[model samples]
Target: MKIGLYVLSIVCLLLIGCGDEKDSTPLVETTNKNQKPAITSKAIEDFDYTDYALSPESEEALANWEKYQELAIQIGYLKKADLSFFNGEIEDLKKFIDQFKTETPKQLLTNSIISRTAILETMLLKLNENLTLENIDDKLKLLSVRELLVAFSNLNYQINKKLESDIFNEIQPE
Candidate 1:
């Protein structure tokens, strides 16, 4: 009977020793607003659209300059690489892209411009959809944003190229 008690006590002591230690320190709940993840550091590079500048001629051809301005502002937001801000601005960005695509200037209404806009629209929709899903990856969101930005830049480049071609053709001998 004494041996039995000793064995039971040893088992109890082993179980107690194997138990997880509970932290006695109370966790303070502080609301940390706008907390950025460490992975976001230097994740996106600054986009310079200066080289892709629309000539004065192309700028003047805009059916809705305000739409273009709004797009520029959104691009600025993307350049800042703030994922949360980008997620919040997705709807507004969609509106801007839709307006710009629909109201494309007559002079710049090339197949390339149309295709680029379509690509951009698709990318935005995909990103927005991913963000709505449960436990979406941040890296995936960043990649989508990058692709969308590239599509926008391509649209600008196509517009400038088209405008320059038109201008050059006008100057050539008939």
Candidate 2:
């Protein structure tokens, strides 16, 4: 009976010790109301294709420009979702959309980017109506916020691939 009690006490102490091990990382919440969440350490910058010497009328330039516009729309959606979560400010998101519009090349304004932008606009409107970080999952039915960010990264990769291919094609003698 004494041995049984000792074994049970040991088991109980082990269980108690295991329960005390909580995560040690400190949670640092952003105190500044105006600050945006640092989702990524790197900031997304606008790409200027003119450095590539891509002529406005060339077929490759047109294709790459179309891709660039699509990528910008994708990035816009991601930024909208992120800002909505962090700041819950509709005006900020609208301004982000405006930035994309102003940056797009005039000749490269294709139907693809326009249609995607319309969809993103509708999403922003819906988000504005029900602005809460808790409902972000429900708001973006097809993808969670993390997935949307991943999609944005993938779009960036696609743009890089297009640029690399364009450069390679230019180097090869026709």
Q: How many pairs of residues collide in each model?
A: 0, 0
Quantify all predictions' global Cα lDDT against the true fold.
0.70, 0.49
Model 2 steric clash pairs: none
The 10-residue segment of model 1 with minimum total lDDT is 44-53
Candidate 1 residue lDDT tens string, 1-174: 999999999999999998998998999987566777523436666433333666687777663667666666676666675445346556675776678677766666678878877886887677666666647776776667677677767777888888888888889575
lDDT of 2 at 14: 94
For this target, which candidate reaches the highest lDDT against the unseen true structure? Answer: 1
Off by over 4 Å in 1: 1-35, 38-41, 46-51, 83-86, 89-97
Best by TM-score: 1
Clashing pairs in 1: none
In the order shown, the candidates' Cα RMSDs to the true structure are 5.7, 13.5
